[model samples]
Target: MKSGINAIIWEDSANKDYGMQNTGLKSPERTRPHHIAVLAYQGLCLFEFATVMEVLGNRPDASATAWYHLDVCSLEGAQVRATGGALVEATGGREALLSADSIIVPGWRLGPVPQEITSALLEAHAGGTRIASVCTGAFVLAAAGLLDGRRATTHWKYAGTLADAAPAATIEPGVLYIDEGNVVTSAGSVAGIDMLLHLMRRDHGVEASNKVARMMVAPPQREGGQAQFIEHTRPLKAAPAIGAVLDAIRRDPAGEHSVSEMALKAHMSTRTFFRRFKAATGHTPLEWILLERLRLAKDMLEYTDLTIDRIAFEAGFGAGDTFRHHFRRIVGASPIAYRRSFQTV
Candidate 1:
């Protein structure tokens, strides 16, 4: 939603089951269901932990024969206290990690991670298990030395702390998540849903991922590069003229909006306008305009039956080829493919 896209409606696939053969997409050869181990500890963050469950665990639409084999492994014990004093019963222990194809660490409690947990994670990674962290769970992966020299992300509020804690890792606070081959790290809270959906896309395909996301009533694909929900640091006394320019651009993204024209409309020189615009909106004028146009184009793609050429022109991209290029580059999918994945009608 922060990316300005609406939730996608599920298109009923020909194959109601989990197999991808009917979708014309080949899934990775798997004789058995993939094993996913979710780590549970005391004072666990319930929402992040549940996101992994909801995404990868069994559901009405997911057949047990084809869905992932999810095990809640307790780091503390069989019984662990989650947030708000809720108790969770884990199905397995740390030994589950070694056999899992993927391991998910939900948000971690602040402070030192237990040596045993870190040791287990290290062994799991060493055995070719892909590891992922949601929110503060990144601290655990950092402690395990899994994030060293890799690009990772966490809640923007904790980005500085994580940077200090794992100096060897590159911390990107703006994006929703980062997938570094075998290591994946996501931002705080609900961003974990996005990251998990991305994993579903990688494991299954766009159709299968879209099916799962539809069940959750979420967007099928929000680009990982999409910024986190961080408020802009706009000053209260910021120039009203810059605001007017921004409003005008948003109102008519299809209109010709050159830098000189915007500067003139804002009653300032180009240099002064550029400074004021960035301070107020946290983006350059061009960047903001491009984002607005893309947002509009995405809405059209999902909610309307507009042709690609017409939508491209309406969104100010001028030509379908240019629109397709930018859409794939920024949204990580072609406009047509995005339409197929998200079109509500």
Candidate 2:
């Protein structure tokens, strides 16, 4: 095991664990689950809508004892066509906004959001409801002025336009998502899945989030700090060679694949290989290898009942001490603590 590094130990009891305000498991006046309202509009991006539904609507552990209500709402309570031309009827109108505990905007397809929807969003924010947007849906939140002066991110392809439009909002490009307290914004497509999973983790704890992720057949956490597009970094001319090396590294992150070895395999000199590799992957050879290993370690921590040393070895960290050092630096938690936080019965 790698030695000589002191790891910061965090007290689990002192850690902040947030819970939903309205689970509706027991109530004196009425039996009502905490409501999550999704904004449905014409020309909506269907995938993001489906993501919200899949993550929140169908919890595997949900039963008569554990459930949260979902509401599909829009300005007019009418059937709307998706971007692909499929029709969908909403559960209610703008009036539903008043009762929602959290509101989600999947994605805004057509330009010029209706004033009514924007107004409802603003009202909801002013009334202390949590608001989140996926992809171009950040535009809707920006229009409502909910993202003003807050750090946010959107699809990197549209980041420039959103930035130009919302000068007051800090546009952090390339990130998966950004959480600014009550408001959250995510990048394109799958990043939306990460955003909702993050909410589940924050409100219901890691165990609940992991359960939801397993049901979705997806990773429970992909720290919001991760880049939205790692493959785009490669130069077109050198893609095939560098791509092969990257694939190999991913296949065995713990393998001691040195820079010289990778360079020789790619048929490039060490200097050229370093430059080209950095260009294609947005990270240096060492950084990318560590990232992949850490990612594997995180998955093991969440899903497998393995000891820290075994997980470290499987993740290519060689020693439990080395794993602890890198895990603390990247994930901000020790391996044991991270597993403890996400541990399930």
Candidate 3:
């Protein structure tokens, strides 16, 4: 990643403060509960819509004094059709969006957003209501002109379409989510859970977010990025020899498997191995190894009380500084911060 991108990622990971301070919104006061309005529309994405309710709507515990107040709003009167032939009744109307501290737009149908919805979102955003989208819900935000000039993402399948639809926005389909201060966008389906968990972490605290993750039976933090979930041009099965090599690396990522050694093991020249590896995995051999090592390191960080140097050695990074550098560059957070955010104990 470029230094600028890395800086943006780092700020998002490190800064727990929410809202657009530059845009004149006061930082959330923890003593007072925050209000979140989830927009329900015709042909609603049941899964993505439910994710917002499950993550932010649910109260944490009986002892908690302050929690998010969630309202399901709609532009279409009280009744909206959701996926799977279900009808959802709204708790409020577009007016609820105006008073909300945050607004969530779930996966939307790929079509024009109604003028009323667009105007409501624009007015709400201008009032400093933080807005977020899950999956194709980005199209709704894009239509409202919110994502223009912001870094956003969506399902990899629709990334090209989103790019074409909103040329001013930088669509990064490789990451799980992007936190551009007041505007946040997440990738497809389950990635919404991660993005919501991140929002919980920002609004509340790591411990509070971890407690919510535990209640939901989800990971408090995911490793690496969304690149792992994207499909490759060709399956590893197409190159059985390369498959074996990849399997071996997974089994012992700490082992030294240089390009020459891997090529020799696969009974191919180094040049041929590089070409086949890229074709099969959509990443060069070195990039894959680095990602695998980072995954392993993240696991150790979350599950074990290992020191940085120990994790470096166990994850095959050779040195602590090197491990920290790559971890921050690729994972977008320091090892300590990652563990603090994810570790249960």
**Whole-model lDDT per candidate:** 0.79, 0.75, 0.81
Q: What lDDT tens digits, residue by residue, belong to model 2 across residues 1-345?
A: 111111111111112222233433322222555578899988889999999998887665535444457889977548988877888899888777767878999978848877898899888777778888999899999888888888888887788799987899999765667777688888887889888877765555567678888887897765323231332332355488898998788788778999999999999999999999888777899998988888778778879898999999999988999998877665545677677766663
* Leading candidate by lDDT: 3
The RMSD of every model to the true structure, in order and in angstroms, is: 9.4, 10.9, 8.2
What would the per-residue lDDT of candidate 1 be over residues 1-345, giving only the tens digit for each residue?
001111122211111221223444445656666788999999999989988998887343534465578999987889999999999999999778788888999999889999999999999888788899999999999999999999899987899799999999999786677777688888888878878877776676677778888888898755333331343333455578987888788789888899999999999999999998988877888988887888889889989999999999999999999998777666655688778767997
Kindly report which residue stretches of model 2 are placed more than 4 angstroms away from their true locations once superposed.
1-32, 223-345
Clashing pairs in 1: none
Clashing pairs in 2: 233-280, 234-280
lDDT, residue 247, model 3: 84
TM-score of 3: 0.64
- Tell me the tens digit of each residue's lDDT in model 3 across 189-267: 8889988987876676667878889998998876545554444333535489898888888889888889999998889
- Ordered from best to worst lDDT, the candidate numbers read 3, 1, 2
Model 1, CA-based lDDT = 0.79
Q: After superposition, how far is residue 54 of candidate 3 from its true place, in Å?
A: 0.8
